[model samples]
Target chain A: MLIKKGAEADIYLEPFRNVLHGAGQGKVMVKQRISKRYRIPEMDRQLRVSRTMLEAKLFSDAKRAGVPTPLVYEVDREDTRIVMEFIRGRQVKLILDSLNPGLRRKLCRLIGRYVARLHRAGIVHGDLTTSNMIFTDEGRIYFVDFGLGGYDSSIEARGVDLHLLRRALQSIHFRITDDAYRAVLSGYRREFGKGAGEVIKRAEEIGRRGRYIQKEARACR
Target chain B: MLCLGIEGTAHTFGIGIADSKGKILANVSRVYVPEQGGIHPREAARFHAVNARRVLDEALNVAGIELEDIDLVAFSQGPGLGPVLRTAATAARALAARLGIPIVGVNHCIAHIEIGRLTGRIHDPVTLYVSGGNTQIIAFDAGRYRIFGETLDIPVGNCLDVFAREAGLSHPGGPNVERLARRGRRYIQLPYAVKGMDMSFSGLMTEAVRRYRDGAHLPDVCFSLQETAFAALVEVTERALAHTEKKEVMLTGGVASNMRLRTMLELMADEHRVKFFVPPSEFCRDCGANIAWTGLLAYLHGVRQRLDDTEVRQRWRTDEVDVPWRGK
Candidate 1:
């Protein structure tokens, strides 16, 4: 049964068995990239296939880089689909505001640390929003949704990735943005080490370029 | 009550008269065309200053109202070239001072949205405002209009304009590019960048230009550019629409005049079973009518702008201001 009709993919939850790693019965989430009738058929197919492969690669790359991500059990290249381990945990987006200040800070800090790990390995979680995260009952954060992500080690890509996260915090969790962002920065600085400052500075610069920071105003000229 | 609005944000100097009932009495604009290159802010401001009296008088004459009969004055107060914004602001202040009426400064971005809503009679909409310098998807929530998504780097319209210039097209090249795109059959592959709801057009622009220089057909490159950029925009707008669940969608700003964009958005809106609105192209572009209407909305809501507080904010953002006129 179709569970969620996302723009890029439709998600389905079904029972599965991990035959490769011993008999383990569990639920797996199958995400299929739905084709759009609006896009030209040729380009649409090309994008779907390439993006599906890209996302699967991102999952493995991120996992190997020390980030906790859902394991990709199977990939259907032609259908542009993936069957991955289903995360049975509360999404960070829904529970963020309900958490105590201390817990919130710790959770946000963990999120920052995971992002640092991804950047350190030259990967950007492109859609780095709270909704794209799952806070396991085990007190760990698992990143999801590599749909928009790309494999790039450039500082601009890394910085833009963080900036996108900051924007998410401001828009969705406005109340705790100040503390949440600061804690995230602290954790990032701690984990990222020598290269953290440059990425952080670039992130700030990227933020300024958006409509929000508009310092030098000139247009249509 | 009647309010006269002045718009000189970039290259156009316009004057429009509107009543409190959201009726536009008269809207006249004089666009300053640069001689050789891009618009020079100082020259544009001088154009606005020189044409201010005639434009204001003509607007009043067209509105069938005397200067003394005006109840308020409004002007575009920002996110634009410094000299241009100041020129419009000075004209508005002088008009209000001479007429002994209150004055309000309108945010250029919000003005575009308001004009669409007011004219289209749309209650609330996911607005895809695309212009040469700005591309923002906005929706009203809580007590203010918030940006759902926007361009991360250069806006979509700018991408087309720059590519047009490189293709040896004249200034204001969007239309010329669109015309050429219609005749092209091939779709040269171009970069399509959409990160969540936000889009990045610089890469697409760079690749399209590089393809043109690499011996690809000009029309093919133009077609590919439009296809890629417009698709990215439509995709982002669809995301915003899905997220907000707004029943209506609006397309406005300078780029709204493109028929292909309108068709693409219309199709997307149809697929989602949502209403699609595009105010007449005249009111879609940067105009005095939008400023006048937005100012009237703010003024009627009891928002005041003291003379000391009427300074133009070159960095004004759409989400930064409170929309007292709109309710949840």
Candidate 2:
């Protein structure tokens, strides 16, 4: 069954098979990076292969760093597909408004801690939106779709990652974003320690830079 | 009743006369084309100041109505250059004072969407507003035109214009680039930077220019640039469409004039099974008719700006406005 069709990849729910015994296993998600017709064929192939490999590695790294992520079952670089454990949960974005206030705060703080753990491990979830997160029935938050994820230790990269999440929250959950993001910062500071303050500061600076660029563009116009 | 709208947000200073029924009786614009490079705010403001009288006269003459026939005055109230916005605001203020009519300050970005909705006969659409200064995917949700996605860095049109300037093309590089891209066959690889729903075109522009400087064919470079950038735009618009689930999709702003972009958006709309609408080219570009039409909407909804409250907001956001006209 087709799960979702994104700009870069198409997600499908397929049965996982045991290769050794030719036995049927449970369902798994197959994320295949489709070839873009607009790009040169060779370049498109190269990008798909490299990106598929990179995403699989990043998912494993994130899981090792204490963040909950879908376990990778297999990777087919030739087909630009990654078969992973299918997460049975609702997207956080869809359930945010329905969540109780206390539960929402707790969930946001948990997300912040998970993000801190990833940052400590030098893994950045490049696309950190509520849609990229899932809340399982077990009360655990699982990150999914690491297509834009990367290994980066730079403060700028980490800051940008947080900035992207902040923007996503602001756009998607405008009413609760301010309080939710504050809880996230509190949790991040508690877990990440001294570096957390600096990263937070850098995120603010990055936001200001975006506004400055917009102002400059307007002035030029 | 009639409204006279003054638009001087960017390079164009226009005067449009429209009735309460949304009929544009007259629309005239005088754009400030720089000798070279991008727009200079001061120069553009001066152009508006110099041409304001002539444009107003032309619009009134075309409408065959005297100044007294106008019942209200409107001006683009922001999200634009400070100097340029002030120039238009000043003209609007003076005209309103002389005519003893109410003045309304309208959001320039919202005006674009309102004009599209009015002229194209589309209601409650997910708007892809792409212009020289702004690029945003917006939808009316929760009593406001909420921004679903936007350019994280430079706008799409600015990227195109700057790249064209670097490539030695004429000003307003969108059309010229489109013309050149028609003859190109090769699809050179350029950076496609769409992060979530937001897009970044500055990197793509830089990469395209670098390729052109590295002895690549100009036409090929232009084609790659358009394809990559427009693809990013289309991707974000599609995401917004999926998120909002609006029944209609509308395109507005100057960049909507590009056939390639229009075709891409049309295909996306078709796939989503939603009605697609784009106003005529005259309505697509920055024009005073949009301001006048939107001003009428606000006026009918009891939105009136006092003389003291007519200040221009250079950084006004589309979602900041109450938009009571679009009642819940």
Candidate 3:
């Protein structure tokens, strides 16, 4: 079944079976990068193939770092598709208002910890947003969609990653942003230890740089 | 009420007269086009200072109204070059003080959207504002215009212009590049940089220049550059539209005059099944009318700035200003 048609990719739900082993079977999500008609066909295919392969690698890297993510089952570079374990849950963005205050805080804290772990493993979720998170019935939060993610250990990259999340919170969950983000930072510090402080500091610096650019741009105008 | 608006934010100095009933009586503008390079701040300000009176007089003549008949004065207060903004603000203050009319300072970026909304008759749209110095995807959320995405480095227009100049094309490379791109049949590979909702164009610009220097066909290089940059823009815009679930998409800013960019945005809007709007080419570029129209809204909503507060802000963010005219 067709799930969602995003700007860069189209997602579908399908049942997958291990034909070689004839043993394991489950539902999977097939995320196919859609070819943009405006792009050259060869260049488009190259981008799709590389991005698909990178996403599959990042998923495993993030999972190994203690972040809950959908398991990658197969990567088809030729078709620019990834068949991954289908996550069954509600998007956190849709359920944030419905969740109890304590649960919401706990979920955000866990998300912070997960993000911290990913960063510690040199994985940056480039498109970090509440919409990219899923809350399963089992009370676990799963980070999904690593299409824009990559392995980057630079402090700047990590800061930008967190900055993206902060902006997302400000935009999507403005009501509980302060409390939720505070919990997130605390949880990140607890999980990542001393390194968390540096990343948090860097994130603030990045934010200041953005403000500075705004000011400079205005001044130069 | 008759409101006179002054706009001298960048390369243009304009004066517009509008009434409370949404009638634009006159809109006159004089642009300072640099002979060989990008705008120089002091030069632009000098141009504004020299032409401000002439433009204002032309607007008054076109409107057939005396200065004493104006009920209010509005001017673009920020997000521009310091000298240029100061000149316009000084002009606005002098006019208001002389006439003893209420004066308001408006955000130039928000004014662009408000005028587009006013003229296009669009309500609550995800706005893609692309210009030489600014590129942002904005939508009214919560209480203000929230920026969804923006250029991380150089703006789309600047990217095109810089590349065009490096390739020996004239200033304002957007039109010339577009003209050349029409004849290009192939798309050379160019960097496509989109991080989340934000995009980066400096890399694309650099790569385009490198390819041009390496003997790649000029038309093909231009084609690819535009394709890559515009795709990143469309991707971010499309994401914002989905995330906000807005019912309409509006394209405004100087770059909105580009036919290819408009076509790309329109296609995305059609796919999302939302109304698409772009003001006429004249309004798409900077002008006094937008500032005037937006200022009228602000004044009607009881927004007024003290003379002391009339000092221009070099970096006025669109979200920093409150939109009392837009009710939550």
Candidate 4:
């Protein structure tokens, strides 16, 4: 496997390619490693192995629930990384930035549905950055990187996940304001049912309280 | 031996006396209310100039301890408003010099933890220290307090106070919000931002004001706002305990007096099977009693500062102490 290194972890891209050689025609990618330092060799090995196992489990769980996530090809716990299907298109951020408002709205609604599907399966994406989502060449959206993911049914957790997405959309697609964000909420409600509305409402409450605090502090200062 | 601690941090001037043990013989505080807004350093200092002696004398009288009975003098060193800190430093140096006693400068945050230990006896508990001036989740490591998590921007109480103003509430906004929140429903939804162990309140505050302007019920909005913000704090505190594997949690600082916040922390502790310790209302707020009690410990352990060693620091962190660790 050819390993690609980033600032935080190493990514092995060749494992999926080699696995697909037997299938004759397919492209795959792998992101199965977390960097370790300071721990003893044995502890590092254990941490990496456990993290890889968690990632693989998270991937399969999301896939079984029909969430559009990368297909896990192979997981090597000892090496602390996994190989998965290679996404062909760029991050949703790039597309959202370059597209017109209409396309941007469409993409946000699509992303909203995808997120709702994941949360419905009781999985909370701890990190929901724009960079963590990819837009396929065929216009499909795929969620990636379950490194900080976990299972939780708390409305707060789900709300926080959606909040991150909303913030990401607003920050990344700066042109889109509350109206577009509400559209994303509508998409979440449509997919996740009435529960999404309650969750979104709660998320809005959190956002409001946060803003009041800041404005007040500034005014006081 | 008797120890006297002076705390002139933020807008409060606290005076306390403690014995060799952690028993607080007396504790007194003088509060400064800025006419226009938040704590103004110069104005607060002026208030302290006039009121410090009154509070100190009252505390001494309440404790029934004379100036000669004070064997050790302590003062809050930093992580507070500079003008307030100078007022405290000046008092401690003067007292220590006149009384011929050693002075020990204590970190205000650490004093909170130590006082929590005294009041609730959670020796190695994770601490959620939230006040108008500071917000942090702390654990004892390597002899000093280590910050496990903290607000990325404003402190929680300050955030609450800010929102209170937007709601047209009083200056010390937390208690006022809690008072008015009971009348509100949980309908007005807001954002809850907990990024890893760290949290942020800026976005949520902005959204809350917008919703209020749009005619959201003020009471319901206040209730929901407190619920979400307190919930975020609970989540972060729980995460810190889980991460550190500590089974005891301590809540400290001025905001600790809020019943709603206490209830939230209590529930989280219950869910995690961790014992939660909250100091009595007096110790919970910004007071010199905690400082006095904590200084007593340092004095017992032979830690002392010369009379001339009274240097006021505006940003002294709790983790900067060079003490030896005593594990649980």
| TM-score of every candidate's chain A | 0.92, 0.93, 0.91, 0.81
| lDDT tens digits by residue: candidate 4, A106-184 | 8778767777888899988766766677888898878777766778889988877776666555434546557567767
Q: Write the per-residue lDDT of candidate 2 for residues B260-328, one digit (tens) a residue.
A: 899888877877788999988888888899899989899999997899999998878888898998996
* lDDT measured at residue B208 in model 4 versus the true structure, 0 to 100: 80
Chain B TM-score for the candidates in order? 0.98, 0.99, 0.99, 0.95
The residue pairs in collision within model 3 are A218-B314, A219-B314, A220-B81, A221-B80, A221-B81
- Model 3 DockQ class: acceptable
Shift in Å, residue B47, candidate 2: 0.7
Candidate 3 lDDT over residue span A1-221, tens digit each: 88898878999987676421356677778899988764557766877888999999999999999998999888888788988889999999999867899988888889889988998898999999999999999989998889899888988888888888888888888888788888889888888888788888988876665532643553456
Candidate 3 chain B: worst 10 consecutive residues by lDDT?
Answer: B264-273
lDDT of 1 by residue, B1-328 (tens): 8888888777789988899999999898999887865567888899989998888888888999888888989999987878899999998888878777899999989999998888887889999999876899998877878888898888777788889988889978899999999987888888888876678898999999999999999888888899889988888888778777789999998999999899989988888889999999889888898889899999999889888898998868888888898864
iRMS per model in Å:
2.6, 3.1, 2.7, 13.2
Residues A1-221, model 2: lDDT tens digits = 88887757889997777421248577888899987654446556877898899999999999999999999988998889998989999999999877889999999999899989999999888788899899999989999978888888999788888887887888788889888899888888888888898899998876665532585655654
- lDDT for each of the candidates? 0.86, 0.87, 0.86, 0.75
lDDT of 1 at A199: 91
Candidate 4 residue B326 C-alpha distance from true site, Å: 3.0
For residues B209-328, write the lDDT of model 4, one tens digit per residue. Answer: 888888888887788778777777776776567556788988988889888888878866776677988888888888888888878887777676776666876656565665432532
Worst 10 residues of 4 chain A by lDDT: A35-44
Q: What DockQ does every candidate get? A: 0.44, 0.39, 0.43, 0.04
